[model samples]
Target: MTYTTEIIINKPRKEIIKTFEDSSLFPHWQRGLKRSRVISGKAGEEGSKRRLYINIEGQSIKMTETIIKKNLPEEWHGQYTSKGMKSIQKNYFEALDDHKTKWTSQSEFEFSGFMKLISKLLPDMFKKRSVMVQQDFKTFIEEGKPVKTN
Candidate 1:
């Protein structure tokens, strides 16, 4: 499945890009994110891989993230692989003005095994989670307050 979601951050594109690129700030905005550790290459550069530990509901989910493309302040594309799911997220940032930026994400998910059933049964779950993260990021960058859902 594929969908697009966007959020307007009340910050300049440069600041938004810088903050988004900081892995240290991920847990603050990415709901349920517990921790991440780089396994290969440079942390944020293309071809780098990281293991992400996230607690969703009461389940501890683990996923591997591999950066596919990185164009600072404009685009960052990556693929996240989990047990039965592979998600490709392409993010774009546009400066609306000197003080505001628009962040858009084009996300696609491929599923197999049991996750295929889950995805078919609850497609909106993925989309909802994506939007939630975007909204949380907006709040984080604009107000410096990360809305922790867990």
Candidate 2:
């Protein structure tokens, strides 16, 4: 499955990129993220790998993310793999003006095993999650609101 999501952030592109590129800030916006740690290569560089632990509802999930491209303030691409799914995410950033920035995210997912059936049954779930994350990011940047986690 493939989908795209877009959001306009009320911040300069450079400011948004600064916060986006900082791994330490991820958990503030990614509601369920419990931890993120670099596993290989260099953080934020192409080919770097990171391990992400997340909790959704009552389920614990582990995912590995590998940076595919990092152009900064312009574009970034990453491949994320989990137990039965792989996702390729491409992100684009544009400066709409001096104080507004546009973020566009394209996601492609490949599922296997049970995840394949789930993907077919709940395709909108993936897209909704992406939109939620993007909205969370906008809130984080504009309103200083971090995702509330229990």
Give the TM-score of each candidate. Answer: 0.96, 0.97
Q: Please tell me which predicted candidate would have the highest lDDT against the true structure.
A: 2
Total clashing pairs in model 1: 0
- Write one digit per residue (lDDT tens) for candidate 1, span 1-150: 999999888899999888889999998999889999999999899999999999987889999999999997899999999999999999999999999999999999999999999998998999999999999898888778877632
Tens digit of per-residue lDDT, candidate 2, span 35-90:
98999998899999999999976789999999999998799999999999999999
Candidate 1: global Cα-lDDT? 0.92
Q: List the residue pairs that clash in candidate 1.
A: none
Which clashing pairs does model 2 show? Answer: none
What's the C-alpha lDDT at position 50 in model 2? 98
